[model samples]
Target chain A: MNKKCTTDPDRSYKQPEFDLDKYIPGHSVDCVIVGYENQQLKILLVKWKLGGPWALPGGFVGRDQDLEAAAHQVLEERTGLKSIFLQQFHTFGRSDRHSRFKEQMDQVKAISQQLGTMDLKFSKWASQRFISTGYFALTEIKKTCPKPDFLSEKCEWVSLEKLPELIFDHNKIVDKTLKHLRIQLNFLPIGISLMPHKFTMQDLQKLYEAILQRPLERSNFQRKILKLGMLHRNGKLLTGAANKAPYLYSFNLEKYNSMVENGIGFSYLGDKIL
Target chain B: MNKKCTTDPDRSYKQPEFDLDKYIPGHSVDCVIVGYENQQLKILLVKWKLGGPWALPGGFVGRDQDLEAAAHQVLEERTGLKSIFLQQFHTFGRSDRHSRFKEQMDQVKAISQQLGTMDLKFSKWASQRFISTGYFALTEIKKTCPKPDFLSEKCEWVSLEKLPELIFDHNKIVDKTLKHLRIQLNFLPIGISLMPHKFTMQDLQKLYEAILQRPLERSNFQRKILKLGMLHRNGKLLTGAANKAPYLYSFNLEKYNSMVENGIGFSYLGDKIL
Candidate 1:
């Protein structure tokens, strides 16, 4: 069978030096699954499987898996989150993200050895160069029960503005994902999974403001969002701040899904009738 | 100083290995710059520098250059087309787009050797594994004076629908770029660069329809597109074929650019505006 594989007419031996280290040299996927809860946008991250560094939850692709599927699998494993809104935003292939991290691996391994559970082979494997694709997602924070994987110590939600120093170039990856999410928000129903079942206009706007990192003009933001036509207006929220109660809203799931399928191009700067 | 450089205070080595076949494998960027002319979306391609196979206009990156700049340089080299909107849509990193063209390389090399002017060393180098990043652009077909680089025999614009079987997985890359372009069309002023300076409503609609590869309702398409408020009505085109003269329009570049900068959302489908 091996001889037949080597002489197969359809598939020839191209790069015979198929060392896992060589061919699998520099490519990976890192996920930044951002969720909204209590009117805030939070990102799911994991502390290092081995060390103290925190990072956007990530995993390397298995030999037989599609790169994208590997990202979703990583999301499920690290965050206990499944079938959420996931998307690939960017691929970070800078030489520095890999090489700089490799430079620190020996020091990290030395630190681990002193802690008394070090496996040198795994440490070496961890030190190899990698180019990672970035996938972002929006989910309900309360729905996910985050757990650190074999390679990590903790999994937690980190506010985008208050993110800690991350391992490798994960901070940059998170930043890129956040930017992509904000741009997508301008055209997509972003809070469907991120927000709770019922939210006031202010709650949704706060989530948007947090993701955008900019405070929007209130009346305009509310009017524009309501005009999208996917939100189902519900009973008023009895809030202490206002005598006139704020109306609660939920995504009309069927309409929202169909809008996503067809796409919603809502340019705020465009026609007023829309 | 040289000896001290070998063992710096920071580390034992400042430079990592730069092996062409190993560390810094042969990487190239192929530009699938698409242009619309005569109501068709077309791609710019080049014949191989060595021989028969036609592929997207592509070139290698210098060790010191940014990956993005390398793509733009390749575009400029092949088309003398400078600074029309370009984006890196995807990077082809599977170990296959490399070896996928190996069989064709062998046949082409054999023919060239028979011709007695082929350099075996160059031929071998040309066939080496390459991981390429794909960038695409929208530009005026008339403005571009396409020409092949030192490695190609021909350069020209080919209709996207009528493209020949391109060398390697270039056809796949082109397909990927087009899909990305379609998604990003609402955000970009595609009509500005891809269409002639002045065009009838049918011409503009046909261009969008061609890129989208779908039929659009005439009145609805016209209304949604014009509602964006970045088109200027010119006189009228006397279409010798039909009823009345369709109104000729020109894209308002300044307004179109501002819309792109300040997000344009298309929320035409379902109840919500995107």
Candidate 2:
């Protein structure tokens, strides 16, 4: 807040390269960059550069580019993260969904103040009836840097429990994404992808507990997960506990990815005390 | 084709009630009406009035309507069906997805001939970059009284096997919906919603076989399905076979719905023969 940040809101205006021919006007792509750390689920949000509420980092799709590719581009541009697990869950299309976020208009006003120009065409372009597609990505939080786009002031990862007041129905989108993630957890072996290399059985259990919001019996959880054949036992972790240390494990990426793509048959057993 | 039906492509032109304000400019809703009967899956499609390729029944959404409601309205307007099971699966948003359907433009060209007027404004409105949300519904084929809209020549229920080349990417949309449906079959007890009121185990197994696209061992499938506790044993059907009569079952709607909302743990048990 003291020094001028490298990024500014007027980057697009600074470079008058686009004339609507290079962009898809009435559609946008938003990424829900979800990361897990310290047993807490967090999402990355960008504060609009000009004094507005936080918004899911999003951008317009290019005229010739695929919607999915545009989401990846936005993800990379906003967070500097690449090649992570991304899924397109839903598209928000209520007519008034975008219009409900009046606070975001302050961003336009601030841009006008900064640039010393009140461009009506820019305002109209911003206020168009835009239908947005939401893509969610799961990445290791500590592995990459998150940089805000030229239109945002800062990039922050906020915990799901204390999420700020998001613009529009982003909160709803996040909720839907969480539900989808939890559902996928039942069928997809995401532990390895969401975890670091060589973690203990307790660490894996903690991840499952965080997502499922329920406790699992140590023996049963280990048996059920190990039965899937997606994990490889690697030595042991000294947890300083009274009992024997749990075995260290790493997921077989090939097996984990195949299960993610074609789903593993592990959801049938209820959260029973097996 | 024989009667020169009262409905035609120029119907909208005949009524000048609609202005530019009536529709949400660049978003639409499409419905994949699926029905199961005779141990096969089928989908309902509409043909363009001016002799163009067939398409899923779809319509531009109103300026202030929810996208899901628009899908249901489109389904009823085209199929005379209401209050059926509908799910929003995905949204299609490729830049060239809408523009590549040049053959469908013949309908607009035909409208110009029938009305004796060239409506350039209509053509411009039709060529906008529209993004569409896809919704799917399952209903009984025999009970449906499918009726085409003013812009469609006829309504037909096409089997998935002999599906005709559809307009735009509707075929792809249907294929995607089927994949989602199959994945969901692993989680949802849709047998009751997709079947007649009271059906025997053989009938239910046939439906499962149709969806799973493989044979299920008679005893094991029955045991697995019954274990879900979402089904109620009604009576027995005398198959007149050399064995015992197959029992009839109807889904307990409340249990079935709860399972649908929170997926039934049925996906893990693989399609293993008894």
Candidate 3:
């Protein structure tokens, strides 16, 4: 295209001028995809290629894309899950979050040189201070195919209780998400994403315990979850160690969808299951 | 304060920085203090003195202060409520949110005259792109005394139901906060903040209804809230309207605090009253 700025009155020269820097500094998105497998609650994290530092897999939004759409796109790229139950929990904007990048400025320069990027602008963009918006996902572990990006050597589930030292303030991001999750447990269909298509009552209870970081009485857990009217008994999961086979259950999608629409109209307290 | 450039063997001179623009832009914190009073849930908003546009009561974070501390400080300055529970909800970082400030650049001279500031730095700061962290608070409406800053003409409660068109996506921020509030109703001890020290069950229910944006069944609502073991029934409120005097309630602060310290393990769905 010929230089449109020179040819048209409505082009760049006549168009609006914006002071981008004044609005807000470095903005980014970090996703915490919480999944369940083997009766354990797990979080999807990435291991860096060089330092092996784990992080809540995240990315920056493009200038042209919607902020939320960018989060969805990031989720799709990291975990092969699309249009899932995702919610924006919190935004982490503390200045020290950028301190790690500052400390590794020389390392970044060396890497850029190795990657044959002589452009100073690209380097600056890479190291710019970022304020990250946090989005959490409830995913079915078996369904997701997590792939590590260019900067990461591994992308896999790490139990929330055994979390690694995450890069930057990512651990804090996960911590915030967990708090939001605990608060929203009754309102949100957490089991739908965390559990398998068919899970035993024990499995469901364990998932809650994992997220809550405390064990709940078995009978009460069963009774509470069933009262929501969002579960359907499927069959049975036979275990040699158990005297009786626990009935397998699945989330009643119809009821779950309606609850998500109308809300569960429920609240939780000590041993007072909804 | 003389310039200390010298040719001595040990003397070295650092280059002068280009300007404020040369460094990364700073972040901003916008507060959404949702207050409950008179059967309505309201948000604190400010109308700019320089312009007629309204926005969520907000301010910039100082470089040295913690972001959360800065947010709390902003809340204290805007509303005379200190040490309130303020939580960061989301960050609005879309490039489009800066368009209004950018569009005002053409008439910078005229705008500066309206703002009455010779410091070009302040004008540049006002007009630049910003990524603002959204912080929310739950508070008793009557307890706060709203005061507008130099940039605002009015600071007052605008009912969530009948909010005016706010400047540059602040309406979106308030909406998102409400959504979070609804999800958080299960875990957060909101009555401690939004209700008076002593209130009737009806008052508490109204607050919930306002936040949930739905009318809850009265009998079920009473039972569910009561079952939480967090409310201590005080003497009934004598009303001129005359029915059975509704029993006044005050939060069992010890139980509520303990529940928050340790996770509240049970949830009350509004179906089974007892």
Candidate 4:
């Protein structure tokens, strides 16, 4: 993954000696980088340059680093977004998760032919079965300037509704991340981090609805959210809507945090919605 | 850990050479087996025979087994409980988590001396830093007869309030598991698994209070739980007191599952509880 020192490499790669002690072998970190933009929920993904399908922007944990720190580094490298809300929701350790790589051996061969060389050590090590820890990040899509790492073609925001074929268990990771987000939404007002500085009740509602994947009763959502004392009725938004101008509110940080700590409870959708 | 074949092994253990391909290196599974009895929350712990302090009843994941399967295997081996509600909550990946191994080297040495001959391979491999996935299981205490694994002393449920000195990050794992449980309570009618097959509203309320670690208004708690529609009120349980008997409720599986599927939301305790 790329941070500020974004570089592109399309040449023969030299393999390094295998040092099992230097890396937390058989484990990797995958970021389900969820973003909000244009009233749609999206995930930041990377197109591997070598021999793989598109996958979540992921990186190996440094031998010396804490997993959380590694996750932050990966997020920063992949999305150029840091200090956002990130949570380790699940760790996937299925034995057959790497079967996709075997199926994509053709792609591996094609990439090898195109690049004219493959890093032998990397090829051997990367093909091994790996258990991945999944961390989901919520950031405003506009703030992120995603750049691909040396091994990836490009990094871009893909709408969750229209995700391309992903490598390994990445598609499953994205699905789990969404489920975690929805469950978290039941107890926490989760979208303020992705919201603008000031927004109408409708804007907040839209963000929640997007994560929830369903429409919520507008006034009910507003009342429930307001009762948690998370929003400050700052002023009214001057909008193009013909109806009465909806009030603009900024998050009361203190109240929002306490509410998050105490869990603001609300239920949405049902089997009917399903 | 043993399922039913609980044989006491207070002896040194010879560790086998860890084959990298046969197992996912540097990763392990730890089960925070939480059980309830007499209105107290407890965790199943084991004492290592050759080294280490008291720790969670956990085992290694087979090379071919899924992480969840490994957790269940560990749980069943330790607690003799199978097909229970087990959730993988988090993974602990701090580099310094194994500081305890180095710090407790004296204890390891003492155990080695006591065991007459330390299995060099096992000792060296056991003390190495490991990232562990934490899975929490809730089952009725009466049904479980926890047995220690071959590598440790007897297994027993220790009250959450009076935890013994634990090896590595096991204590932190337990605390995190409880936090997960408490958070889960806001969204689901948990502790039902920890309760008797049939329980009064007061029994359920007490269980919640124990988990919540505070008092809740009785009527409010009853009203809230009843509203979830998961409880099927059976005949009332007559008591010696003159007050009206509390209704005994059985979990309506379909309704309870649906309520669990769509989170059951209610928040008790104030800002301080957080």
Candidate 5:
């Protein structure tokens, strides 16, 4: 059932030899690194070399490594983004999570065997049920350098609205992350993490609109956000229509940090939108 | 080094024999079932028969069981409360989580050996590194009937203020759960789950005070809660002083459920308190 493809004589993307004894079995970590660019919300996804479906960038936990540290390592390896604040949103542990991907797994095994990298122990270990912890982070799009892992051939940003069918339960993980982000909008540093250093009021509003997926009333949104006292009003952008040029603003770091530390009530879109 | 106690020849509290092959190793579920009583917040804790420190009710997951189902089973086994909503707040996965309790675990082994239930497989499995998921639930105090597990001799409600040093990282888990509860106060069904069918406004305020650990302004609290329109007034609470009696209120289930589904801005206590 393996799909035939041109083999790389140098084996640049060959699977890394794992010391199965050095890692704990039946537990793994998956990360959803989200970024905003061109007014669209995006997540990092990886595609396996053997013509399989896309999946989140994930790896197993080391036998002695802290769980948070393991998540950090995975984030760095996949995105070249280090020390980003990744939050553990949930743990998914359905016994049949892997059973749905049986055909794809069989194809992976066949491809690995053809490449002469397959071992009985690794095959058995890969087939066991896993209880995976999901962690997510918001990042600035320009700051990341995405790279695929050893087993995958491509890593790219896919818009949330057009996400392809992901392997296993990764799509559910992304949905849960979005729900958590919406609920925690007031507490999260969305502007600082996802937007440019200094942006026009419209730029900030569009970012919120993208996340909330609804158009907020302009005047109301501005009044409530300014009331929080975390934004510094900069000079207006000199557009062709000078009077209509909306003022630029940037986050006042100290006040923003304080408000984020103790959550603010910035839910101006109200209960219906949230 | 085992603490000696009068052992029942019938071995009523004997350790249950586990089929190691039927369960997943290196993972467990710990529950923090918090209940409101006497104007204080309390959590269920269990004391081991061999004189170890108190711990949350916990057990291993079956190889074929869903993670949440395992958590529910643990909750039902310890509290005799069935089918209550249990939320998984965080997963604690430090490699050395059990290292701090080496002496206690050794004592457990010695006691189990004396009781003739110490199998080598079980001992080895128990000593390995475990990554435990922490689940929390809010319930009415009168509804629960606490009972200890096979390894524990006492299961009782312990006030949060007077909690003893718990085994492993359970104290940290409780702190995380409280922070989550505070952040989610507006979205949770606190009144429905923790209050009586008919309660004075004073009782509802007391529950929030216990959770926030500070007193809120009475007029402001009443106004904000009333604005939400999720409580039904059921006449005055008849106390000795009729003129000073506060109004009784019960949750408007339809409205309460709607507000919970779509979150409201109920952080009237201000950002400083949160």
Candidate 6:
């Protein structure tokens, strides 16, 4: 049932440094690093050097590390970002999760050999059932310097709508993360993490539309968001058509934090729209 | 650093049957079975026969079980309820989580001996760091038949306000669960899971108040909930003061389901209340 590794076989493989004894057994962390660019929502994914399919940037939990810290480490390694809005949305622990890859033990041994490491325990450990905590991180797209790890060939941002078939249940993990982001839009200051400090009303609207996965009536959306009073209107953006320029605004952090603390009811979309 | 087992030792001990090979190594599921009664929220907890402190009714994930199915299994074993509204809230995996118990390896061995089992591997496994997924379940309080497992002495409901210090990070788990419940109030049909089939508006208000941890303005609450159109007005509850009798209502399942699917905007509580 092994899927052929059609990736370039001669791509230099770096030996993965893992101390099995220094890590927690049967548990791991997978991060869905989400960023916004060109009004499109994108997630950071890594392609394995031994390649079957692309996967979320993930790693095992350190024996002495917090689950959240493990996720943060993965986020930092892949995106070079810190102090971001990272949340543990869900834990994926179906017994058949590993088996879903449809790879055989021989494949694991071969991959281990190709990596210049013949650790039998590492191969067996990698093939065992692992309950992975899924974390979704919101980071400023322009700031991230995406880097691939020893086991990965490339680290790139993939648009949400165009996500390729991911390895194991990683696809489902991304789906779950997006669902959480939509629900959390009511409670979290998402724009603070994903948008530039000064953004136009259309930029903000597009962000909302991107997360919500639907178009909202412009006037209605603007009116509802302004009513929340967590935004401070700055000078208008000076475009070629001066009269048609939209006002630039920034989040009033104090008011925004307070509003989020009390839980904002972003019900402007109404019952007809989610 | 062992917390002494203070329960009466003379009480007959039953040998717990657990095959370590049949369970996932380092992951578990803890159920915060929440029930509402007498206008207060209550959580189901289990007291160990060889006591330290009461704990959330929890168990290891079966080698072949889904993470959620493990939570449901724990819920069914403790409360005799199935197909409940269960949700995974958070995963607890701090490096010091187990160490916070202040329990030693000797304590594990002693407990094993008391249960007529001296398997060192079992003792070691019990003492190892486990990443436990926390799930909160909402069920009708009266319908549940509370029962303890072989390792426990009593299964009982304790009011949230009066919760005794729970073992390890269980108290923290309950706190996180309550926080999630409050935030989810805007989206989930919690009333349908917790309330009786036919209930007065006052009864429903109490449920909301308990979850929100504050008294809401009555008329304002009524206006907002009624506007949602998810409740069907049924016959009036004729009391001793027939003229002052309140109307009984039930969830209009079709409308309620649709509203929930589209996400309800319960902003009536305003920014002042969470």
Every candidate's DockQ is 0.11, 0.42, 0.24, 0.44, 0.52, 0.51
For model 1, give the TM-score of chain B. 0.80
Give candidate 6 regions above 4 Å deviation.
Answer: A1-16, A101-113, A217-248, A251-262, A266-274, B1-16, B103-113, B217-236, B241-243, B252-260, B267-269, B272-274
Name the top lDDT candidate.
6
lDDT of 5 by residue, A1-274 (tens): 1133233223233356656776899999999998888899999999977786799988889999988888888888776767776889899988888867778668656644443344766766766799999999888767777777776788888899999999878889989988877866756656777877888888888888888888888998888778888889988888887477778899899997887777666664354545
For model 1, residues A1-274, the per-residue Cα lDDT tens digits are 0112122222211223223443343456788888776556778887764456777777766544456677787787765656988887776756556566755566556543443233564455555555577888888777776766655567788776678888778877877776677667656888787788998888888887787666778999888888879999999888687489989999999989887876676543232111
lDDT, each prediction: 0.69, 0.75, 0.71, 0.75, 0.79, 0.80
lDDT of 2 at A251: 91
Q: Across all candidates, what is each one's fraction of true contacts kept? A: 0.05, 0.53, 0.44, 0.58, 0.63, 0.68
Lowest lDDT sum, 10 consecutive residues, model 3 chain A, at A6-15
Candidate 6 docking DockQ: 0.51
- Expressed as tens digits, the lDDT of each residue in A1-274 for candidate 6 is 1134343343232355456777888899999999998899999999876764688998878888999999988888777767888988898888888776666445645565465354666777777778899999998788777777666778888888899998788888988888778877866668889999999989999999999888889999889888889899999898887488889999999988887777776654354334
| TM-score, predicted candidate 4 vs. hidden true structure | 0.83
TM-scores of the models, in the order given: 0.65, 0.83, 0.70, 0.83, 0.87, 0.87
Per-residue C-alpha lDDT of model 1 across residues B1-274, encoded as one tens digit per residue: 0112121122111123212342234467788888887778889887754557888887666554456777777766665657878888876656555565667868656643443233564455556566677888788877766765555667888888789998888889988887678767756767787877888778888987887777889999889889889899989877697788889899898888887776575532233222
Residue runs of model 1 more than 4 Å from their true location after superposition:
A1-23, A49-52, A98-128, A200-202, A215-227, A233-249, A269-274, B1-30, B36-40, B46-66, B80-85, B91-132, B138-155, B165-176, B179-274
Can you rank all candidates by DockQ, best first? 5, 6, 4, 2, 3, 1
Better of 1 and 4 by lDDT: 4
Instruction: Report the candidate with higher lDDT, 4 versus 6.
Output: 6
- Candidate 3 per-residue lDDT over residues A1-274, each given as its tens digit: 1112122222111112322322233667899998887667789898765664678887666555557777787688777667888887777766667665555555554443343233464455555556678899888877777777655667888887788887677777887788778767856768887777888888888888887778888998888889989999988777787488889999888999888887775554445332
Off by over 4 Å in 5: A1-14, A100-116, A219-252, B1-14, B100-116, B233-248
Candidate 6 to native Cα RMSD, angstroms: 6.4
lDDT of 6 at A178: 80
Error of 1 at B186 (Å): 5.5
Best by TM-score: 5
Flag regions of model 3 displaced more than 4 Å.
A1-25, A98-128, A195-209, A212-252, A265-274, B1-27, B36-41, B93-130, B139-144, B159-162, B182-186, B194-260, B263-274
Query: Model 4 segments beyond 4 Å from truth?
Result: A1-21, A100-102, A105-118, A219-274, B1-22, B50-52, B105-118, B217-249, B261-263, B266-274
What lDDT does model 4 reach?
Answer: 0.75
Better of 1 and 6 by DockQ: 6
Tens digit per residue, CA lDDT, model 4, B68-115: 898888887776667998888999999888764666765754564444
